[model samples]
Target: MTTTAPASGAHAAGSAAPGDEPLLEISDLDITFTTSTGHVNAVRGANLTVYPGQTVAIVGESGSGKSTTAMSIARLLPPNGKVTGGTIRFGGKDITKVRNREILALRGSEIGLVPQDPMSNLNPLWKVGFQIREALAANGVAQGAQAKRRTVALLEEAGLPDAERRAGQYPHEYSGGMRQRALIAMGLAARPRLLIADEPTSALDVTVQQQILDHLDTLTGELGTAVLLITHDLGLAAERAQHLVVMYKGQVVESGPALELLQKPQHPYTRRLIAAAPSLASRRLVSVKERAEVVEQARTTAHAEAPATTGSIPRSASDTIVSVEGLTKVFPIRGSVPWKSTPFTAVDDVSFDLRRGTTTAIVGESGSGKSTVAQMVLKLLEPTSGRVLFEGRDITEIKGRDLLALRRRVQPIFQNPYGTLDPTFSIYRTIEEPLRLHGIGNAKSREAKVRDLLEKVSLPASMLQRYPNELSGGQRQRIAIARALALDPEVVVCDEAVSALDVLVQAQVLQLLNDLQAQLGLSYIFITHDLAVVRQIADHTLVMERGRVVEQGDTETVFHSPQQEYTKRLLGAIPGGSIPLAGSETIEVEVDTELGVDAEAEEIAERDGARSPLGEEPTDPFTGAGHV
Candidate 1:
């Protein structure tokens, strides 16, 4: 791995060969932020080079300075931050010292950006087409009818179907993936020479993510646009970028061809990332019969030793903890005429059984009915038809004390920990409130329970006094988990729980969930669009699309042999499935250890005066143990 050295001299005219002339270059870049506490070095001596018509990715964990480095290229750093050193050259000219007017002119026309969080980036009040047209007019590309015509074309080019109709819809009306496509349309509206994408597909479902990347790649390839992609997903980076730049703390740790660097990572941090990635983990699910056979053979060979166990043995029908029969949900799509509406089926005949102390994952793209099914199971939504049997009791008709009792038994851990946690409340109150609501124990007992819950989640009891905003994303999520367990629920419904976290943090949370499940004998309804995560955490998998379950089986069967094209597409869209990982050998990753076994996480936790559930000399993150 080698750093991209600074190039010298005047800008060359016409087209240049690959690596001959840089399109976007940052050399010895130092970015600083002035805070009331003191000065923070956001970026330190960072060096990155993006060549013409090439896709280069900067990979790192959250707060690793990759986004800051990319934002500096467009002079989009926040008011408190400034580039204190080094040069940012675009097409062989230093742009760091360029005036605001020049920057305004250079932006959109010469350099465009597709930022993360499409919902926040787009204006809710404006129509999608209007936003694209606004970009066109601002960049002096076109105006009025010409811009309007171009806007529709841009949307269509970005892969949105029925672009003309979609143009009239606001950001909120569009699905998450659609809003992202519109942003891509706006970014490329001016046909810039370079485009900076900051975690562009981080929030999207796997299939949608693949589509967005494919569209970006196609458009950029045809337009000869250079891309500077900033992302935390190493698998995504490896699959999409020709060259990969690994950033850590505030500097580049490794840089080279994506495949070479991924296959043979030199840096310990890079190796740790590869080891922690669920995308690189085994996708195969060993059949129950085969596993049983192996377990029996091992036990016989032991000759009076303890019985050998197979991972996640299929539970008998009598052990079914929760069963959904003919579950269906419908919503009415109302227009201006209040009395008239169209019936929209959100979930249709979804049925599955969650075995005791096992994980069942529901996976699909956005608006694919996965979340709806989860909501129904959580008793948060009333299904139009069918029943949810919890321990052989129908929960749909329960009310008052019975409903409250049901709620106490089945709790939820949502995706956004910050959103779910009350900012004004301390972690103690947040966790204890559930106990108070359910009248679980006395004041002293509730306090003790909260502390015990925190320890169970691998968080310190010291966190009890802190507010939501004071904790990191991962910490806050852990707090959420602790709160969910305060009532000692038998069933935990995790709605896209780890999807919003960094890969390393995601691994930790998944591991924590598995550990908690093992200790508490809890059953989980894990809802997510991330197949990689399902592969790691789920014993049984259900594939949903267009309000119906297209496939359902053990995780291994679904991944190894899918009967539905939709299921196959979802698996195929998973990033880095084609890229040979650092270790080709498959290791059975035990359910309890999962992502929590990351050595890097343990090291960071120890260094930070915290602790990771890094029990038993960290096992190979690639291995799995049977669910006990």
Candidate 2:
């Protein structure tokens, strides 16, 4: 095997010729873990190649070994895990058996990693800049004042605003997206030949996700870096990667050009992933013109009946389930000196009406007050001004039994199920806890209720004895849903409910929610940063910026004819939104609404100068599919 000199800094653009050696090559790789139960084969016979300046994505569901394979490349696997067989070649040298000193030398300078879950990966005790500077120092890249300056530069390049101030803050001070960007900055600080990004943008909002990915593209292009992307979001894989590898059941099932595989996937798992991706759900949504016409006709009809009501007005009180009236929340930012604190407004005059049996999505990036609004609605937080009315009753000051009654009628399903769920509680106990708290049924009856709820979520009765740790991410979320439904709530506040699940699992959970809503007449206040998900689940959309609602309307109308630049940018930033999926181009949206409203829509489009919601031609970039 041939060897190259250690890289002192970022490689020049196009440093390696077209026929040069592949930067990373894995052949017949096998990985195993020794658990208390027994030996588990995490990966088997996996093979992939990454040439310099190329991007390859590994796509799979949880337990599909995508992350495990990436972890092995950096030799960062858990202590219980081992590379039992096969070869991993880097720079033409077999690294599967490399020494510790040699591996340490290769880590940051040769192989960098941007791990998933920024909070856990980063040290909470250290300042963000100190952690990054440590990477530079450990890699012998820079130290002292030079390393500090480099750290701030890396943070800026990773899309973090106010990099200098942010560097001094701890991980807890930064939001999830900011922390992830910091991790990205640290990973690229040494300019490694390969960057193993494991779901780097999963927790980020759409616009920031785009910015970070764009930054990665620029840095990698300039440095001739090879990227091995591990993600469950196929739309991201389809749009960003030149090659796609599909892994299932601890093995590589298929690998090929990204677009071709997405358009004509051979494996059943790959096909299912493509079919379930929410990013491609835009094709299923009504066109901007169609939605605009529908709204216009609806308005015309409503106007003929009630002269005062406008299209922008929230639904009438008769059908409205929950009304948020000028909701606002102010948090105090404590200063170093006692009693010196600044008030931070989290939600400013956010008003909306959630109609019965429909979903209202609050969409925005972090710190946009989406969660604050949800909290106020759930009665988890107090609003400094404004009120939340449930079924025409103000819930702000309710206490004791009234609050208990409200809790029974309204429930919340939070983003991270693992964080919310008690690890000590079995599935049965977790679901039963809610029923017990409400004193709804006897122990025997509650057992039956728990079993029925499991069936509602499509989970087996056998899982009742399992702990949360034993369940997959999707399963945990389903359990959360079951618990939320235990009280037979009228309204459910799902905060980033399915954002962490794989595409297929997310599709299933979304379908389950829709099914539940249809059967039980439930209203959902869905708070999320993913516009792709909003298209699939929300009936109405509210776009927030800073702490204010910049736009609000029917989901279709708001998505297609966004009035605000922030909304337009969010829509454009959706991964795979611009990639036309196969068969999506020719799908027609047949509208049976009143005719002659198209002219009004055109007039509005001209008045607003709104860009096409989907941006360019609806052609799948991966498949080279033609425009719609």
Candidate 3:
């Protein structure tokens, strides 16, 4: 990594890069959060810069204060965070002293932000057109038809289809990739000079994530907008960014060129992070005859283990886990005004199978019916029209005792582990409750099992007593996995499960999942928009768009030689091949989320108790397919 040779006595990373002056300069930036326990100095004294038209990435694990640093620049940090000490200068202006209005203008017009999740970023109530107008209006653009016209042009510019039609639809109406495009459109509406993307592609499937990243790269190159990318994915930072910033415990542990920092990272954190991300080489080694076996298995309806175990996921007839046929989901557009609009097809004719013990990833942007498919598979909602087979039996209709039986066979790990579990419940109770319900053991035995599960995840038993809030992002996620594993179902549906985690944590979690799969012979439906992750873990890949499969094949074939332009765009968008960072040899997931055990987790109302008749945890949080 270039940062390995950053300015030492004279060329400290805080210094200017060679001759060019920085466009955005931050010096000795110190930020802290006032927590009840004490003060969490999220961003310690740190220094960094983004030169003209240069992209600088702040890479770190969770609680590294990387996000805190960027958010402070835009004055977007939460109420608890304070810029304790620092000087932020943009275009020679002291932003620290700038008024709210000027800072606001600088935000949308001079700087754009592509937030983490499309679902939360875009307004569910407004149309793409209105949101664009709102953005422009905030940037001093006059409101009216002119703004509407520009909105359509911008949508088309961002590569959305039927811009005119999409303009009138709500956030729920657009596909996942399309929604991200719309959010990008909103950010670029006023032609900002800089773009701040916080985990922009984290929640997407690999294909859609790539497209969005490619679009951003093209847009920035064309408009010369400086980019400040904050992420945990080192591969992404290395692939797309020109410069790098590594943070740890709110400190600038390291900073250098993206390529340099990745290839020859000096900091231990940087090394660990790069080591966590999966690469083609590592994937090839771990998956036996991965490519050959995937094609062979894809053609052969009967599932069985591949001859060579180097390039593919293990297979079994019973492992021919989930199969979907002619799935259709439509939503009625309810308008208060009479004859205002019509219903639309959200997902149509989606069919695919998740073979046993293998990872069949569903790749797409947001709202592409990926999540809808997952929901239907989990029988969270009856498919608008379709059939779902679990272990060769229709699960869509199964209920009562039979349905409970199916639930035990399938388990899910959600995207945001923090939000998946309850803030109130301790990890101990959370993981143990499921064990008790399944009649696996009594209170003592269940507690021991919970602790054992935590140990398997590399967490201490003491963590089981603490609430979700006390743990780090990666740690909380570990708990979530332990809880999911309590049932040890035949199939696991992970919906963007590792997206929110920092790169190292993400890697750890992915590795954990991989280990679990090998040890337990588990089957998984791994849904994500991360190509990097898909390339490493997926046995077979299915690319989705507008609620349909645009491409489906073995992982290597699909990634190395994509058949569809959309697929190509998605692959190209991933921060791969370019970044020369150390890559992971395993798919281990380590993350923390506030979502923990809740009323929903417990079966208090039902006589069956919390124990799923299927002997598994219950959640409709989009694990059958991946969604944001």
**Model 3, 151-205: lDDT tens per residue?**
8898999999899998999988887778889888888888887788888876666
TM-scores for all predictions: 0.87, 0.84, 0.74
> How would you encode candidate 1's per-residue C-alpha lDDT over 65-170 as one tens digit per residue?
9999998888899999999999999989999998989888989999999999987999888888888998999999999999989988999999999999999998
Instruction: Provide the clashing-pair count of each candidate structure.
Output: 8, 3, 66
Sort by TM-score, top down from the best: 1, 2, 3
Backbone clash pairs for candidate 1 read 285-556, 311-626, 588-623, 588-624, 589-623, 589-624, 590-624, 590-625
Greater TM-score among 1 and 2 belongs to 1
lDDT for each of the candidates? Answer: 0.79, 0.80, 0.72
RMSD of each: 8.4, 14.0, 9.1
Candidate 1: count of backbone clashes, pairs at least 3 residues apart or interchain:
8
Whole-model alpha-carbon lDDT for candidate 3: 0.72
> Candidate 3 — which residues are off by over 4 angstroms?
1-20, 97-114, 122-192, 279-358, 362-402, 438-440, 540-570, 578-628
Pick by TM-score: 1 or 3, better one: 1
